[model samples]
Target: MVVVGAGLSGIAAAHYLRSECPQERFVILEGRDAIGGTWDLFRYPGIRSDSDMFTLGYTFRPWTSDAAIADGAAIRDYIRATAREEGVLPQIRFGHRVTSANWDPATARWNVEAEREGQALRLTCRFLFFCSGYYDYEQGYDPAWPGRESFAGRIVHPQHWPADLDYANQQVVVIGSGATAITLLPSLAAKAAHVTMLQRSPSYIIALPARDAIGRALQAVLPRKAAYRLIRWKNILLSSALFQFSRRRPAAMRNWLVRQAQARFGPTVQQRDLQPRYDPWDQRLCIAPDADVFRAVHSGRASIVTEQVARFVPQGVELASGRVLPADLVVTATGLKLKLLGGARITIDGQPLQVTDALSYKGMMLSGLPNLAMAMGYTNASWTLKCELIARQVCRMLNHIRRQGLDVCVPVLDTDAGQTRPALDLSSGYIQRASGELPRQGSRKPWRIYQNYLLDLFSLNLAPLRDGALRFARRGETPR
Candidate 1:
């Protein structure tokens, strides 16, 4: 077996592989020299998880920190500690970026090719598991705004933030309306002369308490794992309820969210800058821990501009309305680019297989692909929640194959009167941009991807193995 990343998802996959598939041996391949994945890659100011750490943390390992929204450094340390504790550190091969993977049907093995530095390395495994995230590690999604090359101020993308670039007392402009921009506003305002969040339109932003009072109280009274389990369920239920409410009653949820933000931002904030054109959960909601962003805006340290960028001026950005805002530094807090399989070229029996050409099987395995699984998380909740479920399911499948003397397992895509839908339900800018690249989902069970945790838990975690969608076969025989 082979795991494609050594990040949070990969690490979780490793733990499950070791615990459930004990008879199998596997190796973890990481593209970077570090282990934390997103936590290690992102080095911008106030880099933290949008979701609470309790739910984001692994199911086996309980998160002990009082801070629900943990910083990047702490999260990185936690991942490292988890890996070390689980004995997964030594299995990681750093600087080995997988470039191509070809599965041979005759031998039921995957011939994987990767690059380390300037040299090429190859390996073979029975099963290929891709735990690498969806984001493109090479670069973020930065639009080629006009006059960008003519700008005199320093332009930086948050994905590749400079280590020594200081913004002390310098006016900074962050361009985007997503979570990155929302997080940067409060953090940069602390040191910058003035910070402005320039967005074309508003996004639903909510403030969650950094400290979990109920969790703390529960932990103090109950046993270790028991308390953690209770809090995790509580969070899962609340988050799921909120998402369902937003989808069922968009207007009521929008008004309630606006009122929540207003209560934090005080009476002076304008609705144009706070309320989004779309309903809550249309795109994933941005979180402002402890109302920090609203406090910064209320204190006059940061401001919001709801306008489209026409071009870049010598000193700053020129708006569509001919308004020019001065800035010493420009941080493009634009969203990430979706890169599936870590930009690897996949082939089956020497034939090419693009991700877009296949359908996602239960959001893990792809249709017509043998002995492969991907670790993708939930958009509406903590990413780790869905990733953990995927890891567990992969382990279950591995055990089933070993017990039944099967060599391969693949999900068969079922068509419903030739109808199909996009895999993701979000109407976010990034998702819409990558519509052509992402796969489609089936209309019914074992093919449809329900973002709800409860649904996924029942299907992937507790459901029977023989679902009629996931097919199995021997090495020489074709998957039924």
Candidate 2:
């Protein structure tokens, strides 16, 4: 088995693979030299998980920290520690960027091509697990503005924040209303002369405490592992309830969210700046730890401008309403560009695999793809909530295959499965932009990604392996 990436998902996959299939040899391949994936790559002002730590952390590994909302460095260290403890770090090939993978039916193996430095390397594995995240780390999504070249100020994307670039005492303008923009406001406002968050539309932002008091209380009485388990489940239930509430009663949830912000920002904060144009959960809700963004806004250190950018001038962005916001620095938090399997080219039996043409099977494996699985977290809930389940499911499937003496297992979509939907139901700009490039999801069970953790818990983790959609075969035999 070969796992790609050394980040949270990869590490979790490695840990599960080692424990479940101890006799099987495997290796983890990471493109970057570092151990952490997104946590390591993103070094913005205040990089942190939008989800609570308990749910985000792996089920096997308990997050011991007090901060439910941990910073990027802490998350990175946690993953690194897990890798070290699992003893999989030594098996990882850093700097190896997988470019292409081709599965050979005759040999029942994948011929993988990867690049290191300027040279190419090759390897073959029976099973491949892609844990590389769904975005490009080299560059973030930065749209070409009409007059971006004319701007004299330093422009930086959060994905590529410079280490030496000093923004202290400089007027800064951050464009976007996503999690990235919300995180940057509080952090940058502490030192920058003034920070302004400019957004074309509002996003639902909720403030959560940095520390989990209930979790802390549980830790004081129960065993560390027990407390963690309790807290994790509690969070899962709460997150699910919130998502269900948003779906069933969007108007009420929207009002509650706006009121929550109003309590923090007082009456002066405009409704248009906090009230989203779309329903809650349509796009992800931004988290403001301890109401930090609101505190910054109320303190006059930061401000929010709800408007579209007309063009870039020498000073700052000129609003479509003819308002010029003067700034010494500009940060584009415009969101990420989604990539399927980290943009790696895949082929099976000399036939090119167009991901968009394939149906997503259980959101982990693609239709008719043998011995392959990907770790993609839930868009509606904590990523690790679904990722941990995926890791466990892959491990279970691999063990079952080994026990059954099967060489290939592929999820074959039935033509009668009914209508297909977009792979993701997200209305986020990033997801919508990449809709044509991602795989499609069927309208029925096992062939569609339910997105709900509870439903996925049964389908991916506990469901019977011999589902009608999945086909298995021996090394020399064709799948029946």
Candidate 3:
């Protein structure tokens, strides 16, 4: 068995795989020198998770910290500890980047090629699990603006935040309105002379820090398992109710959210820039604590510029509305480009697999693929929850194969109905651009990815192993 990636999801998958199949030979391949993939990579100022740590942290291991919103270092430490405690570190091979993988129908195994420390290596395995996350770790979205090179000022992407770059007392212009933009604005406001958030469009912003007095009290009183369960359920319910309410009665949700934003900015600042045109939840809502960004704006530390970038001038940026914003630094928080299965080049019997042409089975397995599965999490909820459930299901499938002497398990999608589904309803440019390459969820159970945790838990974790859609057969039992 082979696992690609050594991040939280990858480590979790390996941990579970070890527990279930202790005698099986397996190895984890990580491209980086260390574990904690995203946590180690992203080191921007004020970097932290948008979601609460309770739900974001693993269920098997509880996060016993006072701060619900943990910094990058803390999260990194937690992941490292989990890996060490679970004995997953010994099975990982660092500095290994998988280039491509091919399936051999005759041997019923995968032949994977990887580059490790500038040398090519090959491995054969019966199962290949990909946990390499969605974003491009090498280079973030650095769009080719007209005069990006001509700009005399320093420019940076959040993905590669310089360790020694100074922003003190300098005017900073942050480009984009996604989570990174919102996070950067508040932190930069305290040190920079002034910060301007340039947005092509508005994003839904909500405010709630991870740690509150109430949350701490609950954690102290309840057992670790019970507390984690309570917080997970709480977040799931709260997020779902808000999302459903926004969808059902968008006007009301929009008005309430806007009013909250206005209240944070006070009447004067509200008139200038607190109003957003689109309905609430039209895009993924940005979360903060008590409208922190709005407060920064009201305090005259930060401001928002709602205009398209006409071009990049030597001094700064020119707007489409015939305005120019001068800055000493420009941070492009534009967005990410989603890559299907971490851009792994996949082929079966010498035929390449175009992700866009394939249909998803149970949002995990791809159609026409045998004995292979990928972990894809929810866009609406914490990624770890979905990943853990999928890991469990994969284990069950593996167990069934071992018990029944089966060499292959394939998930076949029903194409006879002539129906299709969209991968996501997000308006983010990255998601929109890569929608074709992404997988679609089914309308029925097991195939559908219910963003809700309780429903997915019952369907994925607790459900019976035998299902009609999934086909398990011994070698030579089915025609290849």
Q: CA RMSD for every model?
A: 1.2, 1.1, 2.0
TM-score of 1: 0.98
Each prediction's total of clashing residue pairs, residues at least 3 apart in sequence or on different chains, is: 0, 0, 2
Task: Give a tens-digit lDDT track for model 1, residues 149-256.
Answer: 989989999999999999999999999989999889999999999999999888888888999999999999999899999999999999999999999999999999
C-alpha root-mean-square deviation, candidate 2: 1.1
> Which lDDT tens digits does candidate 2 get at residues 253-355?
9999998888888865798788788999999999999999999999999999999999999988999999999989999999999877877899998899988
For model 1, state the Cα shift of residue 399 in Å.
Answer: 1.1
lDDT of 3 by residue, 1-480 (tens): 898888978988987898877766789999899889889999988888777777778888877675667778898999899999998888999999988898888888889999987899999988888888777788887788888888889999999999999999998999998889998999999999999999887776777765756567778899867876777677778777887898889989887877776677675343435456677765777887556787788789898887889888888998998798999999999887776566678999778986766667766787778777887777776778788888888888888889877888887665441456765656677877777777665667556656677787887778776666678777656722
Candidate 1, position 237, lDDT: 97
Say which prediction, candidate 1 or candidate 2, comes out ahead on lDDT.
1
| Per-prediction TM-score to the true structure, in the order listed | 0.98, 0.98, 0.95
Error of 1 at 214 (Å): 0.5
Give the lowest summed-lDDT range of ten residues in model 3.
267-276
With a 3 Å backbone cut-off (N, CA, C), the pairs that clash in candidate 3 are 207-288, 208-288
Compared with the true structure, all predictions reach lDDT values of: 0.91, 0.90, 0.80
lDDT of 2 at 312: 95
- Worst 10-residue lDDT window for candidate 2 reads 412-421
